[model samples]
Target: MAMAAPAMRMASSASFLPRLLPPTVFSTARAQFLVRQLSLPLFPNFNIAIPVGISLGLPSLPEVLEGIWEGILKAVPKKKTSHMKKRHRQMAGKALKDVTALCVCPACGGMKRMHYVCPTCASTHPADIFSLAPTPSTLISSSGSSSLRIHDTTSPTYPLAQTITNAHKLGCHHLATARGPQTGNIFASVGFGGDVKIWRQNPDSKEYELQWDLPTVSDAGKGDVWAIALSADENFLACTTSDGRIHVWDLAAKEKIQTYETGGGRGAAGGGGSFAMAVDLSRDGRLTASGHENGGVYVFNNDAGRMVYSLSGLAKPVRAVAFSPGCKRLAAAGNAGIIALYDMEHGEHVGNLSAPGNRPSWITSLDWNDTGDYLLSGQLDGKVKVWDVARGACVATHSETDSALWCVRWLPPTERALGPGMGKGERFCAAGASRSLSFYREATGI
Candidate 1:
């Protein structure tokens, strides 16, 4: 009995020894494995930030080795995880863009993701775009569901304050908002169904109330309204039709005032007629310019009711046209991937503004700042450029997206402030084939 007890005690002791030995072996193996993993990649040269895993492991090294490293190099205190979130919030606050969201595409029935084209519909028009009124508080935009929307920019997130649905039976194509305190809130929009509607914000209701709607064509055929423009005082509304005819309407009397033709009522597709691809009203309300699919540009005098200038310059379809805030110069861009600036007073062509190493991508849009000092341009290749008009050079370049740009505009400086730093609050909106609106602000220019 005594021998058996001793043997049992020996067996129990032997089993305890095996358990202790395994723990030591297992710990060694784990330590070796972790060291190998750390040695594999010290750090990646990621531009924005470091990976999270490496940041955590950096503090767990042995203290003895830390002293040896401290003598050879200085160590920066590791960044706290909470600090990352705080820094990001700071950046977003200073960003020129505040609110960005996609407008659901009526054609494709989907959202336009960044850079990627629409997956469902083949149409290329931007989903929703806000045409900021010359005034600071008002904005107008087009939607995919045959609707036109207007927003109040005073809100921090720029919420949609009004929506005009069924404005166009087919769909609304473009929107234009007038400048000035009194005229700023009043705007006009044209739809695919050949109708132009005018909206005014009712002071009593604080809502956009439909003041007038003009049916451009007799029959609501497929060939409908193509483009629209509103004069500075919001008195005269100019609209172009698919039949290549320009119709001018007087809002004060609610009557068709005049009609201008482009010689032939034939447009690009021969649907109704191609009168104009794009149009714009001069800041002074004296001159009106129209771009045609055949790459023709014409400026007419509203008072004279006659074509004053048949500009001979660009040969490709013109997509965008703008008059400098001063009304001295006209800038136009289109499929040729070039912007042609015209001296309206002299009735002569000014020099073209294009970069020397510039690629031959389609120049889809052009906009001049209020002072006419800088011009903002967007292209089909997803490049945004700010041009110095006096120097005739590109001062800054911003790449927003690759989709074709439909429109670009400089947010006018506010009444409270003007100059470089005053624009800290200035933001511009861009919309195009991407079915979304993008906001950008000038990075602090030293």
Candidate 2:
């Protein structure tokens, strides 16, 4: 009876145990308890006792294990994320805002998006740049605009140093600077309005000012002047006319000293000779060369005052002509897309620089580096090429833009005014239909 009484009490006290065990376990225990009660006679030795002061609010095993797993997870270190990755993730769902508003370009009257470069207007000029001339410290650019802009090339930015507004009312087409030691102080420009203006740099202030303009009486002999070149000493100037006449001016006397006629009196009867599209004066002032629209390249003896050589080989219009610094070779290129090299002394077609393809882009401009070992050319298809004059091969080519390139020139090798020493190798600048100027430097292995 005592055992039976304790067993009854233990069974009643077990009501609080359901909190510790799951419902399924509690139900199974209850079923086992009923079976033991019914079989008490078979298990009379079994004893039941209620544990005193036991807590009933303890967690189940599964919940205790789950809490342990959570602690382990909290203690584990997290992977680090880079700032770039975080930025990409944060911007993943965002879209770029579009600029929809348009405005008129003040310079060219062309429409463009606000705060954007005008498609019709060139970098700083309202029209296409026609010529580029480099001094030791500055780069002079003449566009179809009335303004002539000078940029400081010593600095990497090539900042605009000065702007001569309305220098050419009808817009200038060609600019010429002396190539030797006496350069930078004096330069010349020919405008579309048939006027050639001389500009001289101030020795102290370093600012350029108008020296003089060509007299109108000179134009009576020949039509509009199209191109001009300066003598190495800056003492003389050579200009070409639309009627195939090459005129030399003594700048000091401000008088037309000599005139070489390529038109052979045909221009007087209104039948102009093939228009003189390009002209150059040899550095020694011994030779004057002109390239005409009819692919005739003529080299005149400046000392003898007559034509020396009538060069041939190119069948298309000649647009650009340049004499080597040593006066040994002359390079001429134009619509034919081939550069013709001529021996200046013998007036022989020495070689040609051309690509192997059937169709080639027209070469518009050409310049020789100071050493005369390399030649640079700009093409109508927006390509700039550097040629090894000795090897007769194109060494490098750059096609930064697909717009027509009108002018390209090599900056004279000089100590950078902003730096410690002279530039390592050759450097050049190009400008054209993009309305912007691009500068390139030779790649060095150092």
Candidate 3:
């Protein structure tokens, strides 16, 4: 009994012992017949916080459903709408572009609002237009459906004068015209199949015909002729290759005259070069520039037959490159979506042009006006923006379709009777995945 009393006192003073043994029945019964008092819920509220994934594996579906239903109870729709929701709904309703009210202008026969200036000439087409070139009197456009169409921009109807069917069996990717020997009769086009064919405009009938094709260089790889740039004299044609070599062809001789290497070509992939994406010839014919898949921008002193600058601002593949009419500035764009401008004199990254709020869509084409005051850029999002070089701001933006825009070109400067209702001096042409040619004029730029 003394020993039992001592043990009971120790148990009351210490923590629970895992090896507790019950006393004999006689000793326990003789001691007391007291009943053990059961403990009710300590918190009464069983809303205990349980961590996620307490189960060794996945929980049952019914339990998951119960948790989901509990979450739903907390997210029940408000009986009274909040002001922020009302404001958002109102803004959304107003944000949609209202094109249902467009009607063709009687004077110019272009779609416009009831009483506003006719905005643009929306020409309907069948297949995606991939390239466009502007001659003195006509606009030539190409599409994937194996036809190149010529439009007479001088006329009120902009009538199609000719359609050369099956010009490219696999479709053309690029077309380039010389700057100013201004023959207005010669142009070059590069196809996806890697063939470079020259076209000549017949003065008599004003129809174009396949003039000549440059033979592939002895070591040129498959699908090598990707971009073409014609010089001002219309004598030398510069092009980029799949193997990263820039080849300049003498049109008069129909032979490749000079080859500049940035690696690639002869056993290049093992340790030599990358694909060249774009090429451009300066108006003066003194400089030639090319952009490559390695994000290299190389400006070659054509006379020196060597590279001058390998620019480095953009780390993404270069897609489009252009030299200003004066050849003082060069612009390049690519997967980075920003246009990097380089000073030709110093070969320094002078400035960058990008969209205001968001990154621009991949820039597919770039052009500068004759005076070098405005820069035209075409984007994959089917938008064409005209940027003012001096101001560094977007002067205008036009969206014609949801499809990607492949090319945009400024028409040769001309004096024409302004459309009766509008007042823009500049005319530009754009073609893209929609297979249509969209012409835009500066509502008041003349």
After superposition, the stretches of candidate 2 with alpha carbons farther than 4 Å from their true spots are 1-123, 264-272, 416-423
My TM-score estimates for the predictions, one after another, are 0.66, 0.70, 0.73
List candidate 1 segments past 4 Å from native: 1-134, 219-223, 265-274, 357-359, 415-425
Model 2 lDDT, residue 193, Cα: 82
What total of clashing residue pairs does each candidate reach?
10, 2, 6
Q: Order the candidate numbers by lDDT, best to worst.
A: 2, 3, 1
Q: Model 3, residue 154: what's the lDDT?
A: 70
lDDT for every model?
Answer: 0.67, 0.82, 0.75
Kindly give the stretch of ten consecutive residues in candidate 1 with the minimal lDDT sum: 42-51
- Local lDDT at 158 for model 1: 45
Clashing pairs in 1: 126-432, 127-435, 194-225, 242-273, 243-273, 244-273, 244-274, 244-275, 266-274, 267-274
lDDT of 1 at 248: 82
lDDT of 2 by residue, 98-143 (tens): 4566666565677865433454543477789889999888999989
**Top-TM-score candidate index:** 3
Q: Per-residue lDDT tens digits of candidate 1, residues 172-263?
A: 66778775556676777766655678888788887777888776556244345677788888888887766666778888999988877667
C-alpha root-mean-square deviation, each candidate = 16.5, 17.6, 14.0
**Of candidates 3 and 2, the better by lDDT:** 2
Span of ten consecutive residues with least summed lDDT in model 2: 49-58
lDDT per residue (tens digit) for residues 69-104 in model 3 = 988998997799788987797788844565775667
